[model samples]
Target: MIATAREVKDRVIAALNDHDTEVVMQYFARDAVYVGPVGPAEGREQIAWYFEHLLQAFPDLQITPWCKVPACDPAVSAVSEYVMTGTHLGPLLLPGGSMLEATGQRIAVRGAGLCTIENGLIVSDRDYYDQLELFSQLGLCLPEAVA
Candidate 1:
């Protein structure tokens, strides 16, 4: 049986919950791109690197789906928010050529995600989240929020 968009979303969430890079990579297309508040990451290599860094920063990450709607064929668009709270036991690169160690602080960030799947693999994702909140949680530079 072929995998549906919902199935892919579930699997991806499960993979993230497990902190398994291999599993997460399974759902993404080789050329998939991730665009989010943090920044833009293109291709599987960069995507994998980003996830790896995230896993290192928030090893115990869990994603809960707020809602999901299937889009044009083979595409499942989802609007969901996830909370990631973990210790910052690793080095985090900040703006202005600065790095900060994890303060073991807990952070919860709400996000909006749109996942596009093709041939059962995620082709692209557009993520809407707050980078300011993330930075503040990490004790990094805090930029003014958009009014």
Candidate 2:
């Protein structure tokens, strides 16, 4: 039997918490698109790369879903609010082609996600989070503008 949207979302979350990239990729369609803080990753390969990078950066990363909106009859979508906690033990890639070295800082960031499921597989997943908040937790600061 085909899994419902909630089932798929729960399974995906479990896989992510397990830090099993391969297992997480299973719930995504071949052409799935995942848009996260960095940007949009198209296809399973790109999405897998994104997860791998995240896991490498935070080997002990944990995701806790606090709230979930019920899926309707069609069960094509799922929305959830979650918190991700981990330690910065590995290099983190920045948007401007720069890399942030490991700071050994523990971070807890709240975020939300919307998953679009098709045939029990995720076709598209968009994650929303505060980049500034993440950076602040990592002890990073933006330079003040000069007049």
Which residue pairs clash within candidate 1?
Answer: 88-102
Best TM-score among the predictions, by candidate number: 2
Question: Please, what are the lDDT tens digits per residue for candidate 2 over residues 3-44?
Answer: 877788889989989999999999999999999999999999
Model 2 deviation from the true structure expressed as Cα RMSD, one decimal place: 1.2
* TM-scores vs. true structure, each candidate: 0.82, 0.96
Off by over 4 Å in 2: 71-74
Would you list the C-alpha lDDT of every candidate in the order shown? 0.74, 0.91
RMSD of 1: 3.3
Give me the displacement of residue 38 in model 1, in angstroms. Answer: 2.3
Each candidate's number of clashing pairs is 1, 0
Model 2 clash pairs?
A: none
